[model samples]
Target: MSVVVAVKPSARKRNAKVGRLVAAEGTRHAFGSRAAAERWAESLSTGDGHVWIAAAHPADDDDVDCYLVSRATNAKLEAAYDKRRRRLRGGEGGKQQSLGGAE
Candidate 1:
């Protein structure tokens, strides 16, 4: 069992790009970009579930190449970042005051 994720342009937005995640069993999912989809797929692959593979085959008329990333790795990185951010904020997401220093 394996999953396939690909990045391509969006159908509704001319300037937007979308990613598609398709399982070998025919289940499909979509994401904002190839990186996002591959990240998700990588997470799934880390578990005891299906293996996730990223397909970067170029389109017939395109000259760009796709890439892949690990979801577990991304998750770890995000967790570390969030931890640092919380420390910087003293564990409280306080509201910002106006530049004039008045509430």
Candidate 2:
């Protein structure tokens, strides 16, 4: 599932949030699963722990770009994943992109 979610307010607004922590800098993050996305969001908001963003599998990023996301976004998004997944599978909410590390 090549799902992308903003780890921060800016990323969410811009709709470009996804990728591994190593490349999440200015760039947004894309996750492989809702669980992973939620996990990262939780870590970024709650802990002083490091957060990991989802990057294109073969990581084309050169520097670490991950950022901490807000907790509010995480909880709301948990249900959103299910809805979006439906849309993605039905090809209604997306274009030619894959939703979960598929394409």
Candidate 3:
């Protein structure tokens, strides 16, 4: 079976309720191998968002088991972005300093 990769955005509600991600319409791409699908998914995950991958027919979107793929660098990038945003909003932009003396 061919592997399918697509950027499926979260369908979670804004009120902090649980929700599943909805697949993008007409955005799925089929790859011949898992490695190739992973590569493409990783490429699409350069930012804070995640990409979804599943092994099944490209036409079948709902029944296959899906997994998320995110780049390792996304955590660091998201941290920096949050820090910058906080700084812009008049919050501490760096790590908190401990007030206690070293033992």
The whole-model lDDT of each prediction reads 0.44, 0.49, 0.48
Off by over 4 Å in 2: 8-24, 48-103
lDDT per residue as tens, model 3, 3-102: 5555333312211111222332343456687787677555554542455454545576564334433232445788989987887787884445456834
Clashing pairs in 1: none
Q: Residue 37 deviation, candidate 2, in Å?
A: 0.2
| All candidates: CA RMSD (Å) | 13.5, 15.8, 10.0
The lDDT leader among the candidates is 2
Look at candidate 1 and tell me the lDDT of residue 88: 74
lDDT of 1 by residue, 4-75 (tens): 343322211211111223223223454666667657645654423233435655564433334233223345
Better of 2 and 3 by lDDT: 2
Candidate 2, position 12, lDDT = 41
lDDT for model 3, please: 0.48
Better of 1 and 2 by TM-score: 2
Q: What overall lDDT, based on C-alpha atoms, would model 1 receive against the true structure?
A: 0.44
Flag regions of model 1 displaced more than 4 Å.
1-26, 59-103
The residue-level lDDT of candidate 1 at 21 comes to 37
